[model samples]
Target: MVKAAAVVIVVVGALGYYVWDYNTSPTGGKAKSEASASAAAEEAKTHDPEVGDCVKVADPQGEPLPTVVDCNSPQAEYKMGEMLPGTQLECASQYDYGIQYHNSRGFDYTLCFTKV
Candidate 1:
Protein backbone atom coordinates (compact mmCIF):
# COMPACT_ATOMS: atom_id res chain seq x y z
CA MET A 1 0.00 0.00 0.00
CA VAL A 2 2.82 2.41 0.83
CA LYS A 3 4.63 1.63 -2.39
CA ALA A 4 1.52 2.27 -4.45
CA ALA A 5 0.88 5.53 -2.66
CA ALA A 6 4.49 6.65 -3.24
CA VAL A 7 4.28 5.83 -6.98
CA VAL A 8 1.03 7.75 -7.32
CA ILE A 9 2.52 10.71 -5.50
CA VAL A 10 5.55 10.78 -7.72
CA VAL A 11 3.46 10.53 -10.86
CA VAL A 12 1.19 13.34 -9.72
CA GLY A 13 4.15 15.51 -8.84
CA ALA A 14 5.77 14.95 -12.20
CA LEU A 15 2.54 15.78 -13.95
CA GLY A 16 2.18 18.96 -11.98
CA TYR A 17 5.74 20.03 -12.77
CA TYR A 18 5.17 19.40 -16.45
CA VAL A 19 2.05 21.52 -16.44
CA TRP A 20 3.85 24.36 -14.71
CA ASP A 21 6.77 24.16 -17.07
CA TYR A 22 4.48 24.27 -20.06
CA ASN A 23 2.66 27.34 -18.83
CA THR A 24 5.91 29.13 -18.01
CA SER A 25 7.39 28.53 -21.44
CA PRO A 26 8.21 31.63 -23.44
CA THR A 27 5.90 30.58 -26.26
CA GLY A 28 3.14 29.95 -23.76
CA GLY A 29 0.19 27.58 -24.18
CA LYS A 30 -1.22 26.07 -27.35
CA ALA A 31 -3.62 28.97 -27.59
CA LYS A 32 -0.85 31.52 -27.94
CA SER A 33 1.02 29.78 -30.74
CA GLU A 34 -2.17 29.10 -32.65
CA ALA A 35 -3.33 32.67 -32.23
CA SER A 36 0.03 34.10 -33.28
CA ALA A 37 0.23 31.91 -36.34
CA SER A 38 -3.32 32.82 -37.31
CA ALA A 39 -2.59 36.50 -36.94
CA ALA A 40 0.56 36.23 -39.04
CA ALA A 41 -1.32 34.36 -41.74
CA GLU A 42 -3.94 37.06 -41.79
CA GLU A 43 -1.26 39.71 -42.11
CA ALA A 44 0.27 37.87 -45.02
CA LYS A 45 -3.02 38.17 -46.88
CA THR A 46 -2.62 41.94 -47.02
CA HIS A 47 0.56 41.67 -49.06
CA ASP A 48 0.69 44.01 -52.06
CA PRO A 49 3.18 44.09 -54.91
CA GLU A 50 6.12 46.46 -54.55
CA VAL A 51 7.72 48.93 -56.96
CA GLY A 52 9.86 46.24 -58.65
CA ASP A 53 7.05 43.70 -58.57
CA CYS A 54 6.45 42.29 -62.06
CA VAL A 55 3.48 40.57 -63.64
CA LYS A 56 2.21 38.93 -66.85
CA VAL A 57 -0.64 40.50 -68.79
CA ALA A 58 -1.66 40.98 -72.43
CA ASP A 59 0.37 44.21 -72.95
CA PRO A 60 0.59 44.74 -76.69
CA GLN A 61 2.87 47.77 -76.22
CA GLY A 62 5.43 45.60 -74.43
CA GLU A 63 5.21 48.07 -71.56
CA PRO A 64 6.50 45.96 -68.66
CA LEU A 65 4.45 47.16 -65.70
CA PRO A 66 3.39 46.06 -62.25
CA THR A 67 0.33 43.99 -61.45
CA VAL A 68 -2.65 45.70 -59.87
CA VAL A 69 -6.41 45.99 -59.52
CA ASP A 70 -9.16 48.57 -59.96
CA CYS A 71 -10.71 50.37 -56.95
CA ASN A 72 -10.86 53.89 -58.36
CA SER A 73 -13.23 56.04 -60.38
CA PRO A 74 -13.10 56.73 -64.13
CA GLN A 75 -10.78 59.79 -64.08
CA ALA A 76 -8.43 59.66 -61.08
CA GLU A 77 -6.11 56.60 -61.13
CA TYR A 78 -4.58 56.60 -57.72
CA LYS A 79 -1.69 54.25 -57.06
CA MET A 80 -2.70 51.22 -55.05
CA GLY A 81 0.26 48.91 -54.37
CA GLU A 82 2.11 46.55 -56.69
CA MET A 83 1.83 43.35 -58.68
CA LEU A 84 3.55 39.97 -58.80
CA PRO A 85 6.89 39.24 -60.55
CA GLY A 86 7.18 39.11 -64.36
CA THR A 87 3.68 40.01 -65.60
CA GLN A 88 2.68 40.77 -69.22
CA LEU A 89 0.72 44.01 -69.53
CA GLU A 90 -1.60 44.97 -72.37
CA CYS A 91 -2.11 48.48 -73.72
CA ALA A 92 -5.33 50.40 -73.19
CA SER A 93 -5.76 50.32 -76.96
CA GLN A 94 -6.55 46.61 -76.94
CA TYR A 95 -7.98 46.28 -73.41
CA ASP A 96 -9.70 49.69 -73.66
CA TYR A 97 -7.51 51.16 -70.94
CA GLY A 98 -8.70 54.58 -69.84
CA ILE A 99 -7.52 55.43 -66.36
CA GLN A 100 -4.69 53.93 -64.39
CA TYR A 101 -6.37 52.08 -61.54
CA HIS A 102 -4.78 51.42 -58.21
CA ASN A 103 -6.66 49.18 -55.86
CA SER A 104 -5.71 47.63 -52.55
CA ARG A 105 -3.81 44.88 -54.31
CA GLY A 106 -1.60 47.09 -56.47
CA PHE A 107 -1.43 49.86 -59.13
CA ASP A 108 -2.41 49.59 -62.78
CA TYR A 109 -0.78 52.32 -64.96
CA THR A 110 -3.57 52.32 -67.47
CA LEU A 111 -4.30 56.00 -66.99
CA CYS A 112 -2.83 56.91 -70.39
CA PHE A 113 -2.55 53.46 -71.97
CA THR A 114 -6.04 53.51 -73.49
CA LYS A 115 -7.17 53.82 -77.11
CA VAL A 116 -10.46 55.75 -76.77
Candidate 2:
Protein backbone atom coordinates (compact mmCIF):
# COMPACT_ATOMS: atom_id res chain seq x y z
CA MET A 1 0.00 0.00 0.00
CA VAL A 2 1.03 3.65 -0.42
CA LYS A 3 0.87 4.29 3.35
CA ALA A 4 3.21 1.40 4.01
CA ALA A 5 5.67 2.72 1.41
CA ALA A 6 5.49 6.22 2.95
CA VAL A 7 6.21 4.79 6.43
CA VAL A 8 9.28 2.96 5.12
CA ILE A 9 10.58 6.15 3.45
CA VAL A 10 10.09 8.15 6.62
CA VAL A 11 11.94 5.59 8.70
CA VAL A 12 14.83 5.45 6.24
CA GLY A 13 15.07 9.22 6.11
CA ALA A 14 15.20 9.46 9.91
CA LEU A 15 17.92 6.85 10.10
CA GLY A 16 19.99 8.63 7.49
CA TYR A 17 19.71 11.93 9.31
CA TYR A 18 20.89 10.34 12.54
CA VAL A 19 23.86 8.74 10.80
CA TRP A 20 24.87 12.06 9.25
CA ASP A 21 24.45 13.89 12.53
CA TYR A 22 26.57 11.34 14.41
CA ASN A 23 29.41 11.70 11.92
CA THR A 24 29.29 15.49 11.99
CA SER A 25 28.89 16.00 15.73
CA PRO A 26 31.92 17.37 17.53
CA THR A 27 31.43 15.14 20.61
CA GLY A 28 30.43 11.93 18.83
CA GLY A 29 31.68 9.55 16.12
CA LYS A 30 34.90 10.38 14.20
CA ALA A 31 35.26 13.94 15.42
CA LYS A 32 35.04 12.84 19.05
CA SER A 33 37.55 10.04 18.54
CA GLU A 34 40.05 12.39 16.91
CA ALA A 35 39.65 14.95 19.69
CA SER A 36 40.24 12.28 22.34
CA ALA A 37 43.34 11.00 20.55
CA SER A 38 44.77 14.54 20.41
CA ALA A 39 44.04 15.06 24.11
CA ALA A 40 45.75 11.76 25.05
CA ALA A 41 48.84 12.66 23.07
CA GLU A 42 49.10 16.04 24.82
CA GLU A 43 48.56 14.38 28.24
CA ALA A 44 51.37 11.91 27.56
CA LYS A 45 53.70 14.73 26.64
CA THR A 46 52.86 16.62 29.85
CA HIS A 47 53.39 13.53 32.03
CA ASP A 48 56.60 12.35 30.40
CA PRO A 49 59.06 14.99 31.57
CA GLU A 50 62.48 14.48 29.99
CA VAL A 51 66.09 15.08 31.00
CA GLY A 52 67.44 18.64 30.82
CA ASP A 53 63.97 19.91 31.74
CA CYS A 54 64.46 22.95 33.95
CA VAL A 55 61.97 23.39 36.81
CA LYS A 56 61.30 25.83 39.63
CA VAL A 57 60.28 24.33 42.98
CA ALA A 58 58.25 26.59 45.28
CA ASP A 59 58.75 24.73 48.58
CA PRO A 60 61.94 22.79 49.29
CA GLN A 61 60.78 21.03 52.50
CA GLY A 62 57.11 20.63 51.57
CA GLU A 63 55.55 19.00 48.48
CA PRO A 64 57.39 20.51 45.53
CA LEU A 65 55.40 22.48 42.94
CA PRO A 66 57.90 22.36 40.11
CA THR A 67 57.17 24.74 37.29
CA VAL A 68 59.29 23.94 34.27
CA VAL A 69 61.70 26.74 33.42
CA ASP A 70 64.42 27.48 30.91
CA CYS A 71 67.64 25.71 32.01
CA ASN A 72 69.58 28.86 31.07
CA SER A 73 67.63 30.90 33.68
CA PRO A 74 69.00 31.36 37.21
CA GLN A 75 65.56 30.55 38.80
CA ALA A 76 65.58 27.03 37.35
CA GLU A 77 66.13 24.83 40.45
CA TYR A 78 66.85 21.52 38.77
CA LYS A 79 67.45 19.96 35.38
CA MET A 80 65.65 16.59 35.15
CA GLY A 81 67.89 13.63 34.29
CA GLU A 82 66.46 10.24 35.29
CA MET A 83 63.08 8.55 35.68
CA LEU A 84 62.89 6.65 38.96
CA PRO A 85 60.33 4.40 40.68
CA GLY A 86 58.25 5.17 43.81
CA THR A 87 58.34 8.50 45.73
CA GLN A 88 61.46 8.30 47.91
CA LEU A 89 65.18 7.88 47.09
CA GLU A 90 68.63 9.46 47.58
CA CYS A 91 70.66 11.18 44.92
CA ALA A 92 74.25 9.85 44.58
CA SER A 93 75.98 13.15 43.79
CA GLN A 94 75.57 16.82 44.70
CA TYR A 95 73.81 17.47 41.41
CA ASP A 96 70.68 15.38 42.24
CA TYR A 97 68.16 13.67 39.99
CA GLY A 98 64.74 15.10 39.23
CA ILE A 99 61.63 12.89 39.42
CA GLN A 100 58.54 13.29 37.24
CA TYR A 101 55.53 11.23 38.41
CA HIS A 102 52.45 10.24 36.43
CA ASN A 103 49.04 9.58 38.02
CA SER A 104 45.31 10.33 37.72
CA ARG A 105 46.03 13.91 38.75
CA GLY A 106 48.33 16.25 36.81
CA PHE A 107 52.12 16.55 37.31
CA ASP A 108 52.71 15.17 40.83
CA TYR A 109 56.46 14.43 41.19
CA THR A 110 59.44 15.37 43.30
CA LEU A 111 62.54 17.05 41.89
CA CYS A 112 65.49 16.29 44.17
CA PHE A 113 68.52 18.43 43.46
CA THR A 114 70.88 20.93 45.03
CA LYS A 115 70.25 24.65 44.38
CA VAL A 116 71.28 26.00 41.01
Candidate 3:
Protein backbone atom coordinates (compact mmCIF):
# COMPACT_ATOMS: atom_id res chain seq x y z
CA MET A 1 0.00 0.00 0.00
CA VAL A 2 2.79 2.46 0.88
CA LYS A 3 4.67 1.71 -2.37
CA ALA A 4 1.57 2.31 -4.39
CA ALA A 5 0.96 5.66 -2.61
CA ALA A 6 4.52 6.77 -3.30
CA VAL A 7 4.19 5.96 -7.00
CA VAL A 8 0.96 7.95 -7.21
CA ILE A 9 2.52 10.95 -5.50
CA VAL A 10 5.47 10.90 -7.87
CA VAL A 11 3.20 10.74 -10.90
CA VAL A 12 1.08 13.65 -9.72
CA GLY A 13 4.18 15.73 -8.96
CA ALA A 14 5.63 15.06 -12.40
CA LEU A 15 2.39 16.05 -14.11
CA GLY A 16 2.22 19.30 -12.18
CA TYR A 17 5.78 20.16 -13.16
CA TYR A 18 5.08 19.44 -16.81
CA VAL A 19 2.04 21.71 -16.83
CA TRP A 20 3.96 24.55 -15.18
CA ASP A 21 6.88 24.22 -17.56
CA TYR A 22 4.67 24.13 -20.64
CA ASN A 23 2.78 27.26 -19.61
CA THR A 24 5.99 29.14 -18.91
CA SER A 25 7.86 28.06 -22.06
CA PRO A 26 8.21 30.82 -24.61
CA THR A 27 7.11 28.87 -27.70
CA GLY A 28 4.45 27.04 -25.74
CA GLY A 29 3.00 30.29 -24.42
CA LYS A 30 1.23 30.80 -27.73
CA ALA A 31 -1.71 32.92 -26.64
CA LYS A 32 0.35 35.77 -25.21
CA SER A 33 2.93 35.97 -28.04
CA GLU A 34 0.29 35.72 -30.76
CA ALA A 35 -1.76 38.54 -29.28
CA SER A 36 1.25 40.85 -29.03
CA ALA A 37 2.35 40.04 -32.59
CA SER A 38 -1.11 40.83 -33.97
CA ALA A 39 -1.20 44.12 -32.13
CA ALA A 40 2.18 45.09 -33.59
CA ALA A 41 1.07 44.17 -37.11
CA GLU A 42 -2.01 46.37 -36.72
CA GLU A 43 0.13 49.27 -35.55
CA ALA A 44 2.48 48.85 -38.52
CA LYS A 45 -0.43 49.11 -40.98
CA THR A 46 -1.46 52.45 -39.46
CA HIS A 47 1.49 54.10 -41.24
CA ASP A 48 -0.66 54.56 -44.39
CA PRO A 49 -1.62 57.96 -42.94
CA GLU A 50 -4.83 59.12 -41.31
CA VAL A 51 -5.78 62.15 -39.25
CA GLY A 52 -4.42 62.05 -35.70
CA ASP A 53 -1.89 59.34 -36.69
CA CYS A 54 1.63 59.57 -35.33
CA VAL A 55 4.56 59.28 -37.74
CA LYS A 56 8.32 59.26 -37.98
CA VAL A 57 10.36 61.63 -40.14
CA ALA A 58 13.20 60.22 -42.18
CA ASP A 59 14.67 63.67 -42.61
CA PRO A 60 13.75 66.17 -39.94
CA GLN A 61 16.01 69.06 -41.08
CA GLY A 62 15.52 68.93 -44.85
CA GLU A 63 12.29 68.44 -46.82
CA PRO A 64 10.74 65.96 -44.39
CA LEU A 65 9.43 62.56 -45.36
CA PRO A 66 7.04 60.79 -42.99
CA THR A 67 6.51 57.09 -42.31
CA VAL A 68 3.96 55.51 -40.01
CA VAL A 69 5.46 54.12 -36.82
CA ASP A 70 4.01 52.97 -33.56
CA CYS A 71 3.08 56.11 -31.66
CA ASN A 72 4.65 54.69 -28.53
CA SER A 73 7.91 53.91 -30.37
CA PRO A 74 10.95 56.12 -29.86
CA GLN A 75 11.22 56.63 -33.65
CA ALA A 76 7.91 58.53 -33.86
CA GLU A 77 8.62 62.16 -34.68
CA TYR A 78 5.29 63.68 -35.84
CA LYS A 79 1.53 63.41 -35.82
CA MET A 80 -0.94 63.96 -38.69
CA GLY A 81 -3.19 66.05 -36.54
CA GLU A 82 -5.31 67.48 -39.33
CA MET A 83 -6.30 67.19 -42.99
CA LEU A 84 -6.33 70.26 -45.18
CA PRO A 85 -8.65 70.61 -48.23
CA GLY A 86 -6.08 71.16 -50.99
CA THR A 87 -2.33 70.80 -51.63
CA GLN A 88 -1.54 73.94 -49.71
CA LEU A 89 -0.72 73.00 -46.06
CA GLU A 90 -0.76 75.79 -43.54
CA CYS A 91 -0.47 74.01 -40.22
CA ALA A 92 -1.50 76.63 -37.68
CA SER A 93 -1.86 74.46 -34.58
CA GLN A 94 0.67 73.22 -32.04
CA TYR A 95 2.71 70.08 -32.99
CA ASP A 96 2.22 70.94 -36.68
CA TYR A 97 5.64 71.64 -38.15
CA GLY A 98 6.12 70.39 -41.72
CA ILE A 99 4.44 68.60 -44.62
CA GLN A 100 5.11 65.32 -46.38
CA TYR A 101 3.54 64.83 -49.79
CA HIS A 102 2.06 61.55 -50.98
CA ASN A 103 2.65 61.76 -54.74
CA SER A 104 1.54 58.64 -56.56
CA ARG A 105 1.00 57.87 -60.23
CA GLY A 106 -2.71 58.74 -60.41
CA PHE A 107 -3.90 59.18 -56.87
CA ASP A 108 -4.68 62.73 -55.75
CA TYR A 109 -1.58 64.27 -54.21
CA THR A 110 -2.30 64.59 -50.49
CA LEU A 111 -0.39 66.62 -47.91
CA CYS A 112 0.63 64.70 -44.81
CA PHE A 113 2.31 66.28 -41.80
CA THR A 114 5.28 66.32 -39.41
CA LYS A 115 6.14 67.94 -36.08
CA VAL A 116 8.22 70.97 -35.12
- Best of the candidates, TM-score: 2
Rank by lDDT, highest first. Answer: 3, 2, 1
lDDT of model 2 at position 103: 66
lDDT of each: 0.46, 0.66, 0.68
Is 1 or 3 the stronger prediction by TM-score?
A: 3
- Give the alpha carbon lDDT tens digit for every residue of 5-60 in model 3: 99999999999987887677676656577878999988667546677777886666
| lDDT (Cα) of model 2 | 0.66
Which regions in candidate 3 have their CA more than 4 angstroms from the true location?
Answer: 1-47, 100-116
* RMSD, candidate 1, Å: 11.3
For model 1, how does the per-residue alpha-carbon lDDT over 13-110 read when each residue is reduced to its tens digit? Answer: 99998888677776668657778899998654433333322222334255434333343424322342332222234333333332244556764333
Clash pairs (backbone) in predicted model 2: none
Give the Cα error of residue 56 in candidate 3, in Å: 0.8
Mind giving the per-residue lDDT tens digits that candidate 2 earns over 3-69? 9999999999999988998898877688888988999988656534466677776665565456667
